[model samples]
Target: MPVTTELILARHGEAHCNVAGIVGGEATCTGLTDQGHAQVRRLAVRLDQEHTTAPMSALYTSPRRRTVDTAAHLADQLNLETRVEPALRGLDHGEADGRPWTAIKRRFGGRPQQYPHRPIAAGAETWNAFISRCRAVLRRILDKHEGERVLIAAHGETIEASFALFLPLPLDDTELAGQITGHSCLTRWQRHRNTFGHDVWMLAGHNDTNHLRSPMEVIT
Candidate 1:
């Protein structure tokens, strides 16, 4: 009997760059803002409650300040250690790091998602390249923890890439098709072996932000 593998993906909370409308690459990312921390804390509480039903075997985070900070809250809440995965990081903004989106659009001609092969700027990762990297890392993680529940704290783009990998969504139309993931939102997928002995993945959940709803959820 093949057991199911549960993979839960969590988007990082809002950062200063998010509010500032600037690219938040590793070079420029400081960490989560105060409201960001509060958001992650709410998520942490929810994950803690869910842990009783489905205990997480492992926790991973993208190698960015915002993601790491988000994972830190979950780690502390669940008493789990986190493994930083560089491949799980968001698209490389390269020269656009810390730069305003308007400036980047003027310099790079458009957003990185507009072209699959063309990078947003010199040294940046192309949209296609990012999807490939995310798929590879997701495969490695799934294989490493075949039957266990694993959690990942990463960026919204990383979550979008996951959808591209599992759902086989068109790379160009993923975000353009109005598939924007929310901050501190949770998405889940399950891998199971079918009767034909083939592995199939199911989208268990997407953009679940029940944790954010307190007395009243503040729209960011």
Candidate 2:
């Protein structure tokens, strides 16, 4: 029998790097700001209101501080068991870490890409590596939690990578420029086995945060 899985990927609350307009590599600027905390709270309420019938199965988050902080609010609201999964870590900014996005843009004349896989930045991980890990993480999550509603609190790049994993790889640079997952936004993907028993994945939602129409500053 084939299984169905509902996966929700929520970007972590705004971190210091978000406010400072810097490139936050994996685990850098992991803590949330004051408004960031508020964003999580609002997200929690939204989730509670949403899952009145279609309840969640489990909530997972990256080991990073910001994601952990974001999950904490959700955990409290729903009293759900929250697990820390390292595979959900953010992409590496490499030599660009902690540098302002404006500065990197000026230096690279816009987002530099090594095309097929490599990032133009000297020390950064390849785009190929990032998306590959994203695909692998999805497989791992499915293996353990298939046919369930699962939520993952992670990073913007992780969310983008997840969305991109649905697309064919070795992508053109234009396709590589994916959408931004704003602070505390929710993106969802679903998988179900076909009549032939092959699992097919589909995007149910992306970057949804209308529940947070507040005037607070959000990280893109």
Candidate 3:
């Protein structure tokens, strides 16, 4: 029998760049804010209460500080070790890393008409490259962890791109760019073979923040 794989995708909590309104990539703006810590702890508490006896198979996090911090709270509660995944990191903003949004426009001749197709920074990823990385991550998870439950801590755009890999929607790059994945919110997906033996990825949850009990629950 082909078993089902459950994928839990959690967005990292708020970070310095979120408050500063600047672009981020690499190790820039890595630490989670105080509220971010609270958010992740709330999520951990919820998971602890619900899954005290059942620990997930693996915990993977983006190699950035914010995501690492967020994953730590959950991993500690569940007694699981974490692995850093570069494919799970956020989009690289390149030249826009430290510039304010307004300054970014002035410097880059205006924010690329579409973040997916345009690079706000000369060294940043094109939308296609971003999706490709997301696909790679998904493929790895499917191939390696079938029938298991796995948790991932990643970025907003990364989550959106991952969704794009499996969702059969009319969402354009504009729609994908417009999504706001709240801090510490959790999204879930399941993978199983269909009646035709075709592999399918189905969404089970999206942006679930009910675990949050603080102002951090406010979607940014």
* Best of the two (1, 2) by TM-score: 1
Candidate 2 has which clashing residue pairs, if any?
Answer: none
lDDT of 1 at 97: 86
Ranking by TM-score: 1, 3, 2
Lowest-scoring 10 consecutive residues by lDDT in candidate 2? Answer: 111-120
Q: Which portions of model 2 show Cα errors greater than 4 Å? A: 1-3, 112-116, 169-177, 192-199, 214-220
lDDT of 3 by residue, 5-60 (tens): 87888899888878887765674666888988888888877766766565589999
Model 2 C-alpha lDDT per residue in residues 85-126, reported as the tens digit of each score: 877876666888778888876776666443535564778766
| Model 3, runs deviating above 4 Å | 1-3, 105-115, 168-178, 192-199, 214-220
In order of lDDT, best first, we have 1, 2, 3
Clash pairs, candidate 1, are none
Which digits, one per residue and each the tens of the lDDT, describe model 1 over residues 1-220? 3548988999999898899999999899988999899899889888877688778999999999999999999999888999999999999988888899888877766777766778888788888889899988998998999889999998888787888888887656323643668889999988878889988888878999888885433322
Among all candidates shown, the one with the greatest lDDT: 1
Point out the higher-scoring one by lDDT: 2 or 3.
2
Note the Cα lDDT for every prediction shown: 0.86, 0.77, 0.75
User: Each model's TM-score?
Assistant: 0.90, 0.82, 0.84
